[model samples]
Target: MRTRLAAVAENFGRDLDAAYATIDRLLRRARAEGTGLIALPEACLGGYLSSLGSAEDRGTAETRRQRSGPPALALDGPELRRVQEMARDVVVVLGICEDGGTDRYNTAVALTGDGVLGVHRKVHQPLGENLSYAAGSTFEAFETPVGRIGLQICYDKAFPEAARTAALDGARIIVSISAWPGARTAAAADLAQDRWKKRFDLYDQARALENQVVWVASNQAGTFGSLRFVGSAKVVGPGGDVLADTGVDTGVAAADVDVEAELDAARRAMFNLRDRRPDVYGALVREPAHA
Candidate 1:
């Protein structure tokens, strides 16, 4: 019933050694702490530099090694196998540039002892990502020994449908891995001020409060080229409380997440699925106003 989850706000740029080292550290720490689930930033294995151009760009053996190489193996490649070795009864979720047959995807990989559960391709690939990645088509919940977990990437969290579907499908914890550009933070703060902060700020909090499930996000930190990844990786409870968070540097955030508590809150809460008027909602969707 009680699960401890860890999120590492990592730096994923052009350095693969640093990235791998960061993951290694997090794995050791999570194991020592007996963390049930560990989540790493988007592109944690490599960095956010994974794109068609970078993957194809001819470079030295070292340069080629740094790139996510061929995208196809992004999900089940040697890099993941190395990472999987670090798994010690803890479910590790990390992001990678996924390759799907003919196209590439910004995907998040979930791994446990049994093996890789499934890959959740970023449904809503953002601006720069759209150029190099394909959008994900399917949505489903994953059943793990830790609990019923669901995976999502950065931009996908901005949409309500994905989280709602995850919740409706019985996901106790919604894990989102992101590389959200930090450039928007200041502009967003200037626009919304402290009242709202970032545009996706509401989305992060709402995903937990609305779905009545634990919302955990693993985000990038530090600088990647011109982008400054915000390191506010957080764990929000079903009651909308931030259980744990980290500063704007490479670090880890963790908290005790209870599935039974989330389920209890969802059932007892009046605004969740139990209180929804599906019949009326169906009618509203069926009858559209004249445009």
Candidate 2:
């Protein structure tokens, strides 16, 4: 089955109404384009952290009291329900700051008109992120209309184990949603030349090739508060080929792929999953001796 997939690179702020408007517009375009699955940037619902790594990033006491972070939303809240309604036949993957009672989680959710399909809380918290959200515990795959899919957020892409675990669990496609920003210091004037942006693109390809799974990466574009996002949304083939990309701009990268066919073709010559030597990799699951 050839499925049309799209990954978006766009800015989303604190205004819920504005976010919904953007989502509605994107959904309309996806529907018209016959997109079966679409991935939106992290915190597309309420936006990502204003800044990172410094006390000032958290702001003054008064500022923190006024607006500490993105609004925390429940998984079953009206916000997601609205997304489900907009999703209809399309499988939509997006990020949010999940309201986990006393704790908040940077979560990614996959949904359709019927309801939620799967959820993934970011397991790797970068920089000052630990100050805002709790870490997730596992990486798992779930069945969706498009195919068996896995979800990850932002910094999780840096770890090979994260994508490998999902692939081992039978995920044919992995959707990674992020609000990734450029290099914080000595930043490149052109975002396309930024080292962090290069890493973002490299990881998308490397993860896809190593795992032999289709990779869809969506990221926030433009600056938000003190951070400048590196928008490089893309769809990569199992062979590490970039099928489509939004570059360093705000747009959608769309591609049509037959999931099973692509996987079969890619794995025919080099079956990474089948030839794994798990016995020698025992240390991967063990705690660090120093820690």
Candidate 3:
């Protein structure tokens, strides 16, 4: 079946109602245009930028404690119900701060008419996120009406294993929800800016080429507090070609990714699942490359 996919960057912060309204409008637009699935930026459910800043500020402790309550809503709560209402004809994927039983988690939830399919807690929390989040252990793909879809959080996309495992499980497209911070030029001549951000941009392209699958990277835009998210949302085809891209802005970026064509390209390249040597890979895992 032909599939039209959308990747959106929701740049607003702490404005849950406004974000919901924007998403509802986008959902209607996608369905009207015949799109199959829609994915939003990381932490699009509530908001990112989780910093209390100064410890001396009055009521700071109470504010943080309160935030950890109601408005952060559980998966089966009003927040998800609102999302389910908007997701009548399309499958939706989004990131949220999950209020797990004992601790909170950075999670990606897939919602459809069939109800909540699955929730993947982010494996790698990155930098200072460990302060309030727990890492996820499960990784797998689920069958969808459109096609097999995979989910990944921001830092999880940086690991090749994360995407490859999903591909091996028959996911034709890996949808990643990211709030990757935008990069800026270094102020000093002697200092070199970390190139990982650029590497991330390129990795999305390379992952699509290597697995011969569609790679959708949806990132947040603008500043949510102190952190400025990189708003470059994009879609890459099997041959590592960029199919659609959105500049640094809060908007919808879309493209028609032919799932069958991607599989066809994998078959043509002879570099897909059928060709991997699993027996020898075991030895490679046991031996260290160097002293």
What's each prediction's TM-score?
0.84, 0.96, 0.86
As a TM-score, model 2 comes out at 0.96
Q: Write the per-residue lDDT of candidate 2 for residues 187-285, one digit (tens) a residue.
A: 999999999999999999999999999999999999998899999999999999999999999999999999899999999999999999998999999
Q: Indicate the residue-level lDDT of 195 in model 2.
A: 98
| lDDT of model number 3 | 0.76
Residue 256 deviation, candidate 1, in Å? 1.4
Q: Is candidate 1 or 2 superior in lDDT?
A: 2
Worst 10 contiguous positions by lDDT, candidate 1: 188-197
RMSD for each of the candidates: 5.3, 2.0, 4.4
**Candidates in descending lDDT order:** 2, 3, 1
Off by over 4 Å in 2: 57-67, 287-291
The TM-score leader among the candidates is 2
Rank by TM-score, highest first.
2, 3, 1
Question: Which pairs of residues collide in candidate 3?
Answer: none
Two-way TM-score contest, 2 vs 3, winner: 2
Report the C-alpha lDDT of model 3 over 1-291, residue by residue, as the tens digit.
568888887685667898798788889898898888888888887787444233322353235444442235588988888888888868888888888877778888888765787678899776556555668876689887778878899889877778888889988888888887754344222212335356667878878877778888888887666566667688888788888877666777889867887779667857666787787778545756674
- Residue pairs of candidate 2 with colliding backbone atoms: none
